[model samples]
Target chain A: EAGVAQSPRYKIIEKRQSVAFWCNPISGHATLYWYQQILGQGPKLLIQFQNNGVVDDSQLPKDRFSAERLKGVDSTLKIQPAKLEDSAVYLCASSLGGTTVRETQYFGPGTRLLVL
Target chain B: DQQVKQNSPSLSVQEGRISILNCDYTNSMFDYFLWYKKYPAEGPTFLISISSIKDKNEDGRFTVFLNKSAKHLSLHIVPSQPGDSAVYFCAASDITSNTGKLIFGQGTTLQVKP
Candidate 1:
């Protein structure tokens, strides 16, 4: 079985510029998630999508970050007016079901973004 | 408030020896715990998981021990190999949430020497 897929493994942008990351989850997966991993720290949950609807985005920066999963299979995360602090790896993950915590998540290669 | 923490930033062990990684959590609500291994440029891959009800779970050469009373967990890799060298992250989730949201630790980097 194929794992989660992401694009543009590495990205570089100037401060205040906009950048977008794409994610295509595993087949038949019902839940998708976006996370940010800064150097020396573990990945932090940015947003979570259950099918086409958002399940949680409380930790996301509403002023600069946004994400959407229109068809419930693919998702995109965008950051506008990126700041130097936003330089980190953005990881996408997906699980089989949304109702069970036992489902194991499969992660993608991740997009490493750097804002200079 | 950091709910999960890996105090050791790195660990080195000889091949064929044992490698142990530790993690601690402050949240009592976390009922499910998991361990993930990650290479330098790739994302984390699930290694092993143990529920709160169980104190230990083993998979092949990897074993995870959970101490609910102390809110601590450890991952053990026996007869460690060079391929086992990577960053290990400990994650937890509260089943009640039903969303499968995971809270992760800072991660521990393991280096196994040949």
Candidate 2:
């Protein structure tokens, strides 16, 4: 089975420029997530989508970041007027609908973003 | 505030020895905990997980132990091999939420030498 897929494995943008990342989840997976991992840190959830609707986006920077999952299959994350601090690895993950109490999340190769 | 923390940034162990990576969390609402291993430039891969109701979960050479009372959890690798060298992250999730979003700790880099 194919794993989660992400495009533009690496991206470099100047401060104040706009950038966008894309993700395609595994087939049949209903839950999708976007995470940001700064250097030396674990991935932090930026947004989550359940099927065609958003489940959570509490940690996302509303002023600068936005994401959308159309038809709940592929998703896009965008950052406008990037700041140096926005540099980080963006990861996409997907999991089948919850069966047990805990669900296993499979991740993609991740897109490394560097804002200069 | 950082809800999850891995106090140690790095650890080194000789091959064939055991490697223990620790993590702590401040939230009591977490119902599931997981461990993930990541290599440079790649995303984290799920290693093992333990539910809050259970104290231990084992899979092959990897084991996860949870101490809910202390809000501490650990990942233990038996007979650690050089291939196991990578950054290990601990994550927690609150099942009650619709998002089931995971909160992660700073990673611990493990170096296993032959």
Candidate 3:
């Protein structure tokens, strides 16, 4: 079975510029998530989507970051006016269902962003 | 507040030896805990998990022990292998929330020397 897929394994952008990352989750997966991992730190959950509906986004920076999963299969995370502090790896993950605690998440090779 | 924490930033062990990595969480509501292993430039992969009801769970050479009263857990790898060198992260989820959200700790980097 194919795992979660992400695009632009690496990205570089100037401060204040806008950037976007894409994610395509595993087949038949019902839950998708976006996370940010700064250097030397664990991945921080940014947002979660359950079948195109947001389940949680309390940690997301609404002023600069936004994400959407229109069809429930693919997702896109965008950051506008990116700051140096936003330089980090963007990881996408998926699970079979959203209601179960036993669900194991499969992650994709993240998109490493470096804002200069 | 950082609910989960892995105080050790790194650990080195000779191959064929035992490796123990520890984690502590402040939240008592978390009932499920998981361990993930990650290689450089790669996303984390699920390794093992333990529910609060169980004190220990083992799979292959990896074992995870949970102490609910202490709010602590540890992952042990027996006869560590070179391939086991990676960053290990501990994560917890409060099943009562039904949100399926996982809280993760700053990972511990483990190196196995041959």
Q: What overall lDDT goes with each candidate model?
A: 0.95, 0.91, 0.95
Error of 2 at B90 (Å): 0.3
Give one digit per residue, the lDDT tens place, for model 3 in A59-114: 99999999999988999999998999999999999999845657999999999999
DockQ (C-alpha) of model 3? 0.82
Following a full C-alpha superposition, what root-mean-square deviation does model 1 have from the true structure? 0.9
Of candidates 3 and 2, the better by TM-score? 3
Task: Point out the worst 10-residue segment of candidate 3 chain B by lDDT.
Answer: B94-103
Q: Score the docking of each candidate (DockQ).
A: 0.88, 0.75, 0.82
lDDT, candidate 1, at B98: 67
Tell me which of candidates 1 and 2 scores higher on TM-score: 1
Clashing pairs in 1: none
Each prediction's TM-score versus the true structure: 0.98, 0.96, 0.98
Query: For residues B17-55, what per-residue lDDT tens digits would candidate 1 score against the true structure?
Result: 999999999999999999999999999999999999999
> What's the candidate order when arranged by decreasing DockQ?
1, 3, 2
Off by over 4 Å in 3: none
